[model samples]
Each structure stands twice: as structure tokens, then as C-alpha cells.
Target: MEMCNEDKSNDDTQELSLRDKFSKLFNELEHCEKEEQKQKIEETNRLMEEMDKEEFKSFIGYWKEMKCVWSLHFGETSLSKSLKKTIIDEEKRREGKNEKLLVELCECYLFLINTISAELMPICIPCLIKVALKKEESEEAQNEVETALMVMSSAGYWEFMEQELYLNEIKEIIQYHQEYHNLKRLAYQSAWQFLINRLFNDNNLEGMIVNELCFVREAARELDELLCCVDWKREIEREEVIALMRWFQTLALYFEFCHLWNEGYAELISIIVKAFRASRDDHREISKQCIHLLRKAAEIEVIKINDLLKGGAVDLIFEEILQSTSNGEILCDCLNFYLMISRKLKRMEDFKTYEPKRKLIKKEIFEKMEKEGYEDIIISLHETFNYLSKEYFIHLPINISDYFVNV
Candidate 1:
């Protein structure tokens, strides 16, 4: 028996030497057909079984090389429908076994996901996730699912984020369920539950550590990404977006109360601007909220118009409000923001010189008022503004006059 073990160990050592000799030649691997390469790898792996322990472990290095090679191949030729079809078929082949393979495929895909630019991901991830979700006991599958969720959330695909995707058992078996980048998904889910509790479920907070599922970076990034995608001309679901806007503000308020200033500050200001630009249906309320935030930012100098204009932000805002659903409060806010933006730009080297900002303000207010059949209110508002302007200055001259006279 001792001699037999010695013989086996010797055989393993010899095989290890051979695989190690060939492993460095990975780049030239593409010349061979994929199936031929895979077959060769299998033969090598089989031979490795005779190798010593250290040699046998070199499969990991081989696996890594294969992944790099396959990834590049996947790039040069996008996943064929046949391959995707096979992946899907393999996924459905069993009650469960495909999960292991699915997970492995996902890990491979994730490496590429991190390496490639974003546009490619939308094409690949859905395919990857569809397979991963079929497996029940797959940690790798769960990981892939999480990464997919991360990309989805960060990309501001809210409808996708709202879906409860994991298999029931996966969620149950997960001892530590809240992974990184999945927190915003968790938060959105929890908030939905909070709504449901008011409807049919328990209104209890005991079971849900809602904050545990709170992914700060994901939410922050999603908001930032969405703001960048804010196109004033495109038709979008304004209500859903407004809800998202409110969710961000609520998150900011929560963070503020907890003294999480760093987490809340940037996105809070960003969401306010985005909310204004995104405002459509509940625009009266939304615009009012925007004005409230703009005023606050002005006081703090958190988001100045100069900074906004530098980012081409003012144009988007103008286009957004020009198309807003008219209401009393929104109208009032539009007028006030017009005044505020005018004042801010008045000194800016870029826009301070543009008469259109002031002209647009005057033109827009009357256009909106006229469109809304609020001519009487417009006239009244103008008269009220003039009266207040006079009254405001009534005390202005008297301020330094007495002191000058005394001097």
C-alpha cells in the first residue's frame, strides 16, 4: 500500500510538470476551436488527477486563463442565440443542477461586466441573470443576481429594481442576506412593504431593519445616473419619477436626522434639481418642493445657478418648466424660480450678459398664466408684487437717511 501511494504521487508530479509547462501558452489558445480547446483542457485535467497535491491545485490557474480567453471570444462574437438558447435549456434541464454551472457562468460574466463599458452590460446581464435565477441553491447565482441588481439600480431602471427576484428559499437560506450594491433594492422593497402593511400586512417595524437593507452608494449613484439621463424632451413616466424624487428626499431627511450629512448632502441637492426637471403630473406640488429646495440650496450655496448653468442644467430646467402641468403653486414657484435664476445669472459672466434669461422669465410667466386662464390672477400677482416692492423699499431710503442727516 505504501509503495502504491508513492507510485501515485510520482505520477501526479510528472503530470503537474507538463500542465505547468503548457499553462503559460494561454494566449495562443484561441487558434484551436473552443470545443477542441475544452477537450484538451479536460484531458489535461484528467492527467492532473495523477499529479501531486500542489500540481493538482493548478487547475485554479488553468481556470483563470480559460476565463480570460473565453471572455475575449465572447467579445469578438457576442453570445450567439444558440449559445444563449443552450444556456437557457441547460438551466431548465434539471430541478436544480444547472445552478452550479449558471453561477460559474455568472462569475465569468461579472468579470467582463466590470471590464467592459456599460452599454454592453444591458445586452449581456439579462441573459446571465435569466439563467442564474433558475438555480435554487446557488451562491454564485445569488452573487450574479446581486450584481445584476447593482447594475440595474445604479442605472436607474426603477421598474427592474422593484421586482422581488430571488427564489423564496434563497432569501430564507441567506444568513446574511444584505450584500453590497443590493441595498437600494432592499430599501425599495422595504418601503413597498411599509405601504403594504398599511394595506394588508403588519405595520410592525420589529422584523424589518429597514436600514440594514439601505445601500447608500447604490441609491446615491442611481440618483446621480438618473439626473444625467434627465432629458426634458423625452416622454417619461413623470409620476413614478416624482415618487423616486420623493424617496430621495425622504432618504436625505432620514440621513440628516441621523447626522449622515456626507451621505445626504450631494444627492439631496441633486434630487431636488432632478425632481424639478422631472416634474410633470403632480407638478404643482413637485415644483413647490423644487422651489423649497432651490431656496435652501441658495441659502447654503449648495447648488448655485452658476454651477447649474456650467453643467447645461439651466437649459434643461427651463425646458422642463415650460412644459410643466400648470397649477397655482407651480405657477407661483415658476415665477419665483425665474426671479431667483435671473438674479443668480445676473452676475454670471456667461448668462448675466444674456437678456433672454430675464426676457424668458417675463414671457414664460405670462404665457403660463394665459395658458391656464389665470389672467386675473396674473394681473393681481403683478399688482401685489409692485405694491410689495414699493413697501419693501419704503423702509430702504429711511434706513441710511437718518444716519446721514445726523452725520
Candidate 2:
């Protein structure tokens, strides 16, 4: 029988010092045959996990000196190992051996990140960023990008990434990859999910978030093109629609908070209107975001009401309300869309100077609602809204019927 390198101490820590134990494990791991190295590494990880913080830090020092972990995979020091070499090397390309090993390296890297201190993450980020943005073609390349994104998504490293100027890498990755590529699209979409979630949760990162709003607009435009397509049902999946909805929600919140919709406001409003009309009843989440955006536009009155009418905003809301009567969330959103505009026009002192535009907007909206035969539906919607408000304790300063009545 071939005996493994089992410790003879039999669980007796007094027999060997922690340093001696780590040394023994690392030495055995280093000398073990390739087939046995994985088992030895697992044992080492378990031992390291049992160590206290100080002991783990000391082990890091010894492991760095030995270069045991990365050396086994890449035969290069951790400091010098470039993920790109594992990705695009011509020799490795021919042998096909580097691919699996590259995957193992990624797994190992993640494990270390999970088990180690945040102080150690910075050293791994440069290589991660390189492969994340590398536009290579292969499963191995995809694995590299995915793993890099996984590391980037780790909250432990966000501060390091922010300090190191790697914060924009996710945006760059989103811009660099084509949305039509199924596999790569999933990776970047996931990265976007992580990024957007982080941005939404962190209140102190407002300044950093402002710079990303432009990129958000760009992403919204891409989504608009897809959603407006005739074959969008085939091209866009539910997951992609969910991502689009969240992005729109984020953009709408930004507009409401900052009133930064001056740049390309008309075009964006048009896109929002079109997306609402296109998605209709099939994607209520997306429709809810569209209504939210339109309400923000109404609250700010950044674009003239005539421009919104021309963009088909009034008709879009009516159609959405007609189709979404069963979906109370969408119905409430549509009602709020109109009430928001009414509230702004009725309450704002500044609108006194712009009464003609507000009156014209209100007149045109009523005309459209009457001509389209949606007045009764609007009345029914108001009744339902009142019922819901009482049942759910939903309170608004202004009532839906009072929207069209004189202040």
C-alpha cells in the first residue's frame, strides 16, 4: 500500500508548532507528485482556516516565500503571473492543457480571496482587470473574464478598486463587449447586476455615481434598441428585460434627484415612451420603470408638454393602463404618471409664468383621452385607485380625480 503523507502527531498540537505544521504541509505539497498535489492543497486550506488571524498572517508570509500556491499552477511567482498568458499564449493554445489549469487557477484565486484578508486582494486585481477586458475567443478566455468579474464583484475589493482606478473597468467591459454574444453577454450582465446593486445600496458614493450616469444612458439606449425591435421577443430574454428594468429605474431615480435630464432629455423621453408601448402587458417590470421615468419628467417639467405629447406619452399611458388593469402596480404607476404632471403644474409657483403651456398640455391630454375613448377607463381606474389607497393605506397629497379638476 502506498501511504500518504499523513501527520504522525495524531491531532496532538503540542507535538508540533503551528509554523512547523505549516512548513511540513507546504514542503510535502511542494514535493508531492502532480496527482497528489490537489489533496495536499485541500488539507493545507483546512489547516489554514483553523488558524487564528495572526497565525494565518504568518502563514501568508511563509507561503509567499515558498511561492507554493501560484507556482504549482503557472510555474511563475504570484507577482509575475499574467492571466493573459494563460489566455492567449500560442503554445498553450496548441497544447490545450492550459485551459483546465487556468480554470483551476481561477478557483484557487477565489478561494484565497475568500479565506484571506482584504489587504491581499490588491495584488490580484491587475491580472484580473487584464483578462476581464481581454476580447479573446475561447472557453478559457470566457472563464478568465468571468472569474475576473467575480473578483471585482467581491465587496471586499471595491475600496481597493476605487483607489486603484479600476472602478471604471466594469463600465469599460460593458462598453467593449457586444450584446449579441450570448455567453459574454451573460458575464457582463452579471457584472452590471453586481455594480448596480452596489451603487444603489451605498449612500455615500453619490459623487462617484454621477460620473456613471452617462454610461447608464448609453446602456439604456442599447436596451431601447433591442426592446423596440420587431423580433425582440426572440432576441431578448426575461433576464435581459429584468436588467433593463433595473437600469431604467436607476436612471429615473437619478433624474428625480438631480434633474440632470437636460442632456438628450427629449430623446430619452421618447425612448421611454416607445419602450412602454412596446413592452405593454408582457413585461410589467419594464413598464413600471417606464412609467416611473415619465413621472419624473412630469415632476421636473424639463421637456415641454407638447414635446411629450408628440413623443406619444399620453397615448402610451392610456394604452398601458388599459392593458394593465389587472396589474395594480402598473395601474398605480400610470395613475401617478398623470397625477405627477398635474401636481407640478398646479402647485409650483414658477409655473404661473408658464400657465399657457400647462393649460395647453392639460387640454391636449383631455382631448386625447376623450378621443381615444379612454375617459371611462380613466374614471374606473380612479375608482380602483381610491379603493386601493384605502385598503393599502396608500396616501398621496393629491387625488387622481383632482388631477384634471381646477386647483
Candidate 3:
């Protein structure tokens, strides 16, 4: 009985020792200088590695509890003030080492987010934002901004939108990045996260997000300039081309939800059609995005059939279908888009509007399909037309497939 009591006492003492070690580590991490904090992080990692998995998990839980209590006591405002001062001091110092220190400081805050209280968000968010929005032209500064944006993205906090000034500052940064070809990819990623978070929460920022920042009225003009500048045939490095295409695709997606289609529909369609035609096999991803955006535009009725035909979208669609016979997904999308066009034209017949122009375009499309040896496409369209005829009881002014069959 005495041995068992002694064993229990030993276990209690060991548990207390472990608790003390954890508390010491947390306090050191919280209050240490940036370099010391990094060392503490390494120490903490080593300690975690030495612990059993279950013990380590328990330690994490305890750490989170303690951090939450600390955050509540110190408050987010106080934390933000301290962090802002550190950032300003680091910026003013302009030492090469200061960049690393700034990143480390930001990382510390990022790590704290896992345990930080919601009320502390205002403090943490603004600090990261100021760091991201700081106007330094150095590569390190760019990296810092990217890192801060990445950290903010990981937090996935839409509450930042509540601060109008901060939100606009972020928007301006995104807009500024959009003008530089090299930085545009990160800009797009940041914009996507920012816009999507707000969209998911149903927060509207329509009036503030405009042409140069989000959607440009002269998208076609810009696309044409890009095409002229890039010799798609000779440009073996497809990264820039692909990135530009993705930027346009993201813009189309953003416009879809915002009902801002009229803002750039014509230009978007024109650019997508051109991309579909110019993209090489190495750029199959770009081609796929083009098809996806086209399909989306068609489904939303953002790009009218007339506009599509005017943009020669049908010709490009048939070209992709013929070129990608073995690509089942692309083939499927092509067939689906063809069906949408047919249905749209059939609906237009109700108005007896542009009937001749529509018939002429349909004849031209099927003729091109037959000439291009898209017999499978003709068969699919024939089947689809018969099904639609029976389902909708709509009469075709002309036997659509008959044109393909005769050709």
C-alpha cells in the first residue's frame, strides 16, 4: 500500500513538472524577441518530438487554452498596437535582417491564430494588413506582402471586410499587382480568396470594385494587345500566356456571381474564343478553362447565341471537338455547348427575330462541321435535335441535321 501511494505521488509530481515546462515555453514564445522566438519554436518542436503523441496533443490543447486566456486579458487592440510598432521599427531600420525578422513576427501571429480569440481578430488582422500593404519596392517586401496575404488567406477571415478602409487598401494592392504581368498570378489568387470569402458571406462590394481592379470594359482591347505582344507560335514558355488566361477566367467567374456580365461579356467571349484557337497542346489546361468559361457564360445567358456566333465561337468549338476526339471531357463539353446553342436558337424562333440570320449561322456551322469530318458531332446533334423536338414540341424552320447529313 505504501509503494502504490508513493507511485501515485511520483506521477502527480511529474505531471506538475510537465505543466510547468509547457507554461514556460508558451510564455517565452509570447514575449521573446523575434530571433529568440524562432529558437523557442525550434525548442518547442523538439519537445513535441520527445513527447508521446497523445501527450503532445494534450499539450497543444493546454497551450491553446492558455493562449486564449492570455489573448482575452491582453486584448487584441493592445496586441495590434505592439505589432504595428514592431513593423514600423523594422521598416525604418531597413536592415536586410529586418525583413526576416518581420516575416518571423508575422509568422508568430499566424501561429497564434489557431488559438486566438475571435475578439482578438481586429488586432491580428490589421497588423497583417499593414504589413501586406506597406509600400516597399524590395523583393523582400514583395515576399513579405505575399506571405502576409497567404497567412491571411489561411485564416479565411471575412471579418476584415467590416473595416472599409482596410478593405479598400487590400483592393488597391490587388489592383496595383494586376498591372504587373509577373505579380498578376499572386494578385489573382489573393483577389480570388478575398472576393470568394465576401461572396460566401453575401457581402456586397459592387460599387467599389470596378473596371481596372476587377473587370475592364476594354478586355478585348487588352487581350488583343497581349496576343499581338505574344507570338503564341514561338512562345515556348506558356506560363505568362496561361497566367493571363487564368486571370481572364477568374474575372469571368467573379462577374458571374455579381451579375456584372454586361460589363465585359463581348470582350470576354472574344478573348476566350481566341485563346481556344491559339492554345497549344502543352496549354491544354488553358483550353479547358476556355471551354469552361464559355459553357458558364452560355448557361448564365450572359453571352447570347448571337454574340457567340458573331465571335466565331461555333467555329472554335467545332475545331476543339475535331482536334480533341479522344479527349472525352472536352468532347462532352463541346456536345453540351452545341446543345445549348441549338436550344437557344429554337427559343429565339418564338420571337421570329433574327430568324434569317440565325438560319444562316446554323447552316454555316453544320457545313463547317461536315467539311471538318465531325461526323460524330453531326450524329450527336441529330439525336439531340430529335429528342428536343419530341420533348418540347418545337418545329425547326429547317431540318438542322439534314444540312449536316447532306454535306
Clashing residue pairs, backbone N/CA/C < 3 A, model 2: none
CA displacement after TM-score superposition, residue 195 of candidate 2 (Å): 5.6
Candidate with better lDDT, 1 vs 2: 2
lDDT of 1 by residue, 133-239 (tens): 34344565544454433322222111122223322322332213334332333334333322222211222321222343333433455556555665545644443
Report the C-alpha lDDT of model 3 over 287-358, residue by residue, as the tens digit.
777777676666565467666766677777777766634254565566567767776666667777678877
Please give the CA lDDT of all the candidate structures: 0.41, 0.55, 0.56
RMSD each, Å: 21.2, 14.9, 14.3
Q: Give the count of colliding residue pairs in each prediction.
A: 3, 0, 0
320 in model 2: Cα distance from truth in Å? Answer: 3.0
Candidate 1's displacement at residue 216, Å, is 9.1
Question: 355 in model 2: Cα distance from truth in Å?
Answer: 4.2
Model 3 vs. true fold: TM:
0.54
Give lDDT for model 2. 0.55
TM-score of each: 0.28, 0.54, 0.54
